[model samples]
Target: MAPTRQMSRPEESTLDLGEFTLKYRGDALPQPELLVIGKRSGRHKAVHTFVNILDNDGNLVRQAAITPDIASFIFGSFEVRGSTEAFNIYESDLVVGKWSPRTRTNVSPDLVRHQRTIAEQSFTATGGKLAHHWPIFQKLKETGFGSIIRATLTLHQLCSSNCPFCSTILRNKRDSVSLTEAQAFVSTLYNEQAALNRNEFVRYNEEYRRLTGTDIRLKGLILSGGGQPNLWPHFSEFVRWLGELDLDVGLITNGFPPKIAEDVYERFKWVRLSITPESASPFYPDGRFDRQYIPASLRHNDSLTVGLSYVYGPWTDDDMLKRLDASAHENGFRYVRLLTDCNLTRQAQLKAHQDLADRLFRLGFIDEVGKPLSRIFHQLKYHGSQREAEELWSDGQCKLQSYNVFWDTTGHEENGYSHCYPCDSVTVLADEQGETDISVSERRFNADKWGTVKSTEVHRLFTEPLQPFFDPRDICASCLFMNNNRAVSDLVKRASYGDMNLDTSLEHLNFP
Candidate 1:
């Protein structure tokens, strides 16, 4: 293809086809460079389209018919190794497909319009602040051995409190991950020490290349546990060491602890303090407001957002709400999240939260506007009845397990601290007190164990699938990740038909 004749003024030219005329205008620097394509009949209006041509100089390189070869050339060039060529079509504000040479056939106008509608709906469903979970596309594409977006690292198995509803209490009998082992595990992930399969790397690399023209690496690490994470003897040191790595670290702690260094404390992106009477009474005898849960220094820390987590259940009442409200105000806490006690039945859990929310509003803890007043957070709303919750559980396999993982300190006594559970929710259930309603076996608590991390490589648990001791379908009755799992499964099914590009960056929405 070669540059056509230069226009006299306005940088516009027209090529008259029998049915329509292709009018091109403008220099390369501007956006939405107008290309007016008019119908041959004088009755209809000229349809304006935005066209970014092959060359950077914005020149209409050649006057050619709309053939397969011309369509391929007109589309931007993106080289795929095994494929001959790739082209991108920008229509109705939706960028669709990376067509290979073999599939460079012209897309019908009707199909393009339909894609725009679907794309808009998808964007509406996704791309809604932090809830936008486009990372599932990459997660689904890679299947079992793919990228690990976010992880929960249980620093230790020791706790300062014995809460009545402690689910992982049984797992706490085992030893915790020592400072040395914790450092090694984190370093390995950050440095990519474990070799990925050649084919796996190529497949992941191609998808990344298509979406983000460059590499994007993001993995969120939450320092939480089977026991209190803050109770870990080396908590301060481990947190300090974590600052040196490239991971985005979040903390889930029971605010009472050996004070962390001012600088190290600020390294966390967000800090969630789980404040319960049972957990708080041991450290702060007076109450939740006995001491500042988050340090005063971090109160105004621009980078930090501290939140309080309170579980509402059978024992919860108006007095507890008053105490929680007073405590949140006393401390410099910004948000107070109310959660349902997982120990209750699904129906009971839903009713408990609804009742709590209603009580919270009536007590002025939450505003009349159905939002947090100045302290409380608008908790995660649970709509629908018990039957709806049950149906969601039966959707399919837990696909979100491939994206995020739970790493705790329980493993074989002979081996070091190494146990990779599906997620924190599962770990809690597997360790919950005798015979859960979900499973018939009384020993279901001990059924879902993955072998020691050291023997099969800790990182491989994410990239490589190892045999699991328990099937989630059989044992897991209540699923916290049911919605996420369903969303991912739907996206996987959609992407299989090759309709959309997932519109996600390598680092986009990695917390899933």
Candidate 2:
């Protein structure tokens, strides 16, 4: 609960890695002999386990297939003798061994490691950077009862897109939406939003309202389920309806139709178009329904404040991205944002993304032709480059924003961090089999504690009561990103460019 200041004696006790905090003595700590970091918590986590192998340098050397139970991990996994590499671990009610200590230590600056770290760094930086703009946590800390600035909103669990790059696709393991239930879920939220037994929704809304002296509006409205919401004919009606509600409207799509986008843009005006030439190779039929077609459509629509989101990574060719960035900018976007693989899944991909980011920052993070790579991390890295970057940060910890949340109709609720956001805390998920809702109880909505929040209510909060606090550039003064982004972006740039500050004020900060 204390300010996230570094512990001079961290090695003597607690070790904070910005995401997870644990007690370590530097010499020996409760190093679980085996670890199974899964996507979701509780019973939903897949049984992916690996032995805790460390070498003389305190570097993780290797991992064996000793599926040690959490019980042993909490007990003797670290204390066991005889060579952990060779020993078997008891899990699944019996002894198991995936590998032995004799296996060569997989030691190398592996690209896999690089990719994973960059992905994480990217996500955390974006979320935290944006959150720094709010007074939620600061206000809570100064309040009477524990004031937890709540970032909670329920996502409409109805999507049909089976994009390979989507974590949802990996979870649902399908190429299409589950018909029977998916449609019904949509049916429920519409006439259903105001119909829910107001008991729960009202209680929560009022509680936070009294505490913060304001209502928690839904954050951002994402019409996407797993499939494209625009794919549905009524999708326009939905976008138009939400836009009329006086909230910031956003939808992430594969850009199948520019008309759909124009329709939404006409109503919401704030739209995000995410495309992956990597997955949709050749960039046409499989890409944005034909890149030229989409761009042509955008070239004429001057009303859009578009967010160009590319499914780009380290391996993404410079030429490809250059063209991509140029095309998006030419089409009239306010800014471009890359959907980097910050989940640390691919090392090659991660570094390549960072490299592109580096190039951007070295040149003031604007492209060689003088276009703003506003979403690039070299700018973020530049943020961290200040010599006193550490001193200014509270915990000096890295994070992947808060969490990823979507909403169609689940009134107001928050699903904590996941692939798109923070690394830990309460999580809402449908089972691997796509059966039920599995989550950590008492959802932790504290953005400061989790480093991010993915909730529909969040978008609303910003545009509403706190709308007065909203400043694209000036907002930087009170933003959480200032603490982290300024240092990180500065550090990255200084490493490549030099120490300098260009007005990133909202107005000076370019928008398409």
Candidate 3:
């Protein structure tokens, strides 16, 4: 039997107001950046006061109000205890900004009633799956592109591996960018000004301002490739330079020992290694399981998280999965991600993952009730197949495209200026007539091909109005970030009347 894990209760603080006494537990609910207030009218009736949003430093940023319906969504329904009409209020129930660390009370600019911002109030209203990206929703209200909080830098488009399912491998033609160019790109992103003049910054900055009138900067970067990034010549130098920026960096690569410096590799916040079926052959050949198939550097270290991704198809047998699971456990990998081959038919894709779940259950990796036991496998249950013909989304908006920037080798740099794609799925290429050509594929076309970036000056990209050329309903057959799209759309719909609604405060934990 497994030992039961214990959870520590959060410390409590109390506030007395003669008629009603409020008790707050910081950890009882989702963490809140804004304060909330709950007033009791009678024994069971609750009255809530709505007001302007305040920052932690006791400054007014924006005006916001909470209706009764909005208040209930933010604080949740109240529960009465004993005979005294005292309410055990969660931190989320208050109508103020973040509490002062010095004083446990809600930090209000003036009064407790006018504490939380409209964005804070509205963010908690819709507890959707994309709640983590509530920050993006606020920016998306203006343009599809203003909410971008992360960037994917695809440095090269070359791979020697003979993977059968690779779509980008066929397009491997561009040479890796020089180390000088890569370093310059990183520096430009870090500095915030490369091509934009003061006038351009002001013109574009309005679209990206948070509800609190603060500017949102790019928080994370993905070091990936159209092919294997490990094969890039400047991989080591670029990574070492990125370490200087101290930004949350993630790496996606085929499971090969990266020939980079150990300190540089450890700087990555996460490393998602794809251990293909071909890579698994050496581990389980002739019913022999070799633990050394996984490199020591790729295992969970004290600094960074390591995980494995496997594409399941007709080639995947029960034995192969067992070997993969065993290796993940022994290698200290966080989780094993099992995904169906997108090349397969929609029905086949669904069945492939379903069968994987069933097999794992039978093999005792998971219980009969579908709860994990020995292994944690994130089966792509919500995954939409690339072959799906029907539209997975009905909405015309693809706001997620505006929220992230995916730059690849297809994008070009000239005269200290850069023209790039919006997401990995979209690219801008010079046409036969010397005009820009936006390449559209089931995957590629889902993300819009917007404008250019001056050097790595991404400020213009965030501030510019992202006018999508195609509606997602018309072009996007399936998307991996559908939950994010749904969340952004829901938030935009709720905030249509200039009122913001979102979930618990993520404290700027924004990423793609």
User: Backbone clash tally for model 3?
Assistant: 21
| Candidates sorted on TM-score, descending | 1, 3, 2
Q: Give lDDT for model 3.
A: 0.46
Whichever of 1 and 2 has more TM-score, that candidate is: 1
The residue-by-residue lDDT of candidate 1 on 1-512, one tens digit each, is 22233345544544443322334444423211222222422112122222222222212222222233333333323112100111112231122323222211221222211111221222111222122434335554546444555677876666554443445544534556778877766755545522342244565555554553423233568888756676777888888888876667888877655465667678787777776544223566543334635576557555666667777643355776777767666666656676655544333344345556567778876654445565665344222223433464454345545555566665534365466656666533311121122221111124234322442265765555533334445445455555555666565555353455443432223344
Residue 455 in candidate 1 has what lDDT? 23
- Scored against the true structure, residue 186 in model 3 reaches a CA lDDT of 57
Cα lDDT tens digits for candidate 3, 307-347: 66777643455687787777767778766666655533223
In lDDT terms, how accurate is model 1? 0.47
RMSD of 3: 25.0
RMSD of 1: 28.4
Per-residue alpha-carbon lDDT of model 2 for 391-419, expressed as tens digits? Answer: 33334433112112222222122333221
For all predicted structures, in order, the TM-scores are 0.62, 0.42, 0.59
Clashing pairs in 1: 145-463
